[model samples]
Target: MSNTTGAERLRKRAQATALAVILSVAATSSLPSTNEGSKDMQNTGTTSPNASENLTDRQQAIVPIAAFAATGDIANLNTSLDHGLDAGITVTEAKEILVQVYAYAGFPRSLNALAELMKVLDMRKQRGIQDAAGRLPGSPIPTGDALLAAGTANQTRLSGGPVKGALLEFAPAIDVYLKTHLFGDIFERDNLDWQSRELATVSMLSALSGVDSQLQAHMRISMNVGLTANQLRQLGQVLADRVDGNVARRAQEALDRQLAIAPGP
Candidate 1:
């Protein structure tokens, strides 16, 4: 057979396989229905999944960060990069992932996670590994009302609600911050926009052990960013097929959540 035909057949098979796996995972899991439900569930654990089964190159490349973010597993996060870096991932890209998740995950995880990334950097330098410690391509910083206005728009669009003057289940202050800080401050950074950032967040959270609700919410938000149902299904399948065992469950949970909330076609 011709190489092009082989490649075409492979792509179709991959998509089909991904769909089947995603459907299976979606069958048994569930996600919370309200913003209050999300607030009540702030699980922060980390897990490692085996990516040896049948992951593509793109999925494999992103598995580490997603797994680490999902479970907040510092040790595995470190180990994941050890593999990625050795396999030729640049330090800069790794840093960007960690830094970006701070808005979605939180300061504590983000701080600890970034610290871990820095540790990897220090080790890389000592061993002369030559991974990048370079800065982002465009270090754009948001400022003033321009920042606030954009954040407001981003938050409203992402949550499918007003997102302003909303009260938090735990801390009332955080509701404002979500609209202002997460959507406004950190999100306005140009290096990564709302869509790509949310994609990474959904993927990472889905691979986590306990953040199923958050994963589901982001999966919804992910759709708001123009991500199709099939695209999300592929993401879940990619994580399940390629990432660790725990992530398969997480990905499945996320898929179930999406299926529940997805408007009927």
Candidate 2:
């Protein structure tokens, strides 16, 4: 081949190899999002009782529990724990969720969130106030292929159906990585648990404007995780009341839809 042709071919091969490496690393990093987005449920501007009433003090605890655990907002997260502790969520549960989301959300958020939790824990200690404590053995889920399969099953449960993830088609191996890493490694950990994790996932998604599809899917999964409809209704309403400006409208809207489906206790 001519020198120009030979050089161009070599460049293409190098580019392909580089692409493969980058993709492989990404696969190992986090859970992949689905291409089909969650649809925004119709907004109804209601919670349960007032659907309009502000979250009661006890119910309000979910705010920080949801926020810190959801967005990794360190400051807000800390505040949430203090709020939860005062409201009775227990320091141990708050810390566990923060540590657990590291699996679903990522280390950066998880670590920052945990630091905030420790700070709160310290403050509580100084005052001789302790929230409910729980045990964390470190190893909750199994390792290797079993982990991957279990995570996939968990992810599917959250989605309410099978997820033929898109990233895999774009790059085949990535599918395996998500199943192994995001689904397997993280989901396997029992500390955060699936239901609570999805609650955080939905609340965090509500904080964000877009990603409506993912939010809805997680909402569906949240139900699957055993959250009562009233609790879900309470969740959105609390978000609307507390995290106003950006999420208020969306929160109110999500609450409305959930109220419809929520069972009457």
Total clashing pairs for each candidate: 9, 8
RMSD in Å for model 1: 13.9
Instruction: Give the best candidate by TM-score.
Output: 2
Cα lDDT of candidate 1 equals 0.53
Clashing pairs in 2: 37-213, 38-212, 38-213, 38-214, 43-253, 46-51, 47-51, 64-80
Per-residue C-alpha lDDT of model 2 across residues 8-41, encoded as one tens digit per residue: 8656533433233223221111121111111111
On the 0 to 100 scale, the lDDT of residue 34 in model 2 is 14
- TM-score per candidate: 0.61, 0.65
The residue-by-residue lDDT of candidate 1 on 119-218, one tens digit each, is 8878878987777453343434456776667566655445554442212444556545554566665544433334345546766666544555566666
Error of 2 at 135 (Å): 2.1
Residues forming the 10-long window of minimal summed lDDT in candidate 1: 25-34
In candidate 1, which residue pairs clash? 45-71, 46-71, 46-73, 49-244, 49-245, 50-244, 51-242, 66-204, 70-208
